[model samples]
Target: MKRIESSKAGGSQFIPGYVQATDYSDLESFMVAKLKVTGQLDMQIDSDFQNVDGAVSNAVVPELWTGIRDDVRGVYIGEFAFWYSDYISFIAESPNGQFTSDEEREIIEILSSFRTEN
Candidate 1:
């Protein structure tokens, strides 16, 4: 798979991110199935840009299970996903276990501040 777009950020190490194009008939169901199959924890959240046009209404934070991480090693990975309608969303993850809480929030806020056209 290839990313539609991506960006790398600052800090002790890079807090990289990307915009991925995805399609799904039902996002909730798809996420639920993914979480179930993997038996991992995830959550739904509101975006800071929800009031803006084209902002996401339903957002999902699919914990640190979407990428390659050593759960047994207790890697500190952070991930976020915002779903607009059922097919569009922003997904982020730090599989290197290098993201701090502040960085995670920073990522989320940046994600929510952007208004998508579709």
Candidate 2:
């Protein structure tokens, strides 16, 4: 239910509203989410996902990512963790505001297509 209406505020280029959330149960499982809104009603950037890990044994390293793309913008969520450091990345775009959708999509694709160098 955590969703952001736009991609503005917080010095971000997108429109200006967004929702984000994080959840933790015990010390090994956690999740983060984000969403963008349009005109205060529609969900132009419809997107979400979760990342899980085995913190107790520290023997598992897992990550997952998913995305939806369009000319307007792209929405993406990634979850991954290493030991005590948990990482999540959420992104929305407005390369130039006048046309934030296209830019947003491009950003989403790039983030979705990342690979670890190690």
Which parts of model 2 are misplaced by more than 4 Å?
1-34, 38-90, 93-99
Q: Give the least accurate 10-residue stretch of model 2, judged by summed lDDT.
A: 52-61
Model 1 poorest ten-residue lDDT run = 29-38
Considering only N, C-alpha and C atoms within 3 Å, which residue pairs clash in candidate 1?
Answer: none
Model 2 has an lDDT value of 0.28
Cα distance off (Å), candidate 2, residue 65: 9.6
Highest TM-score among the candidates is held by which one? Answer: 1
**How does candidate 1 score on lDDT?**
0.30
Candidate 1: deviation at residue 52, Å? 36
In candidate 1, position 66 carries an lDDT of: 36
| Model 1: per-residue Cα lDDT over 6-57, one tens digit each | 1122111112233364443232222210111112322244222121111111
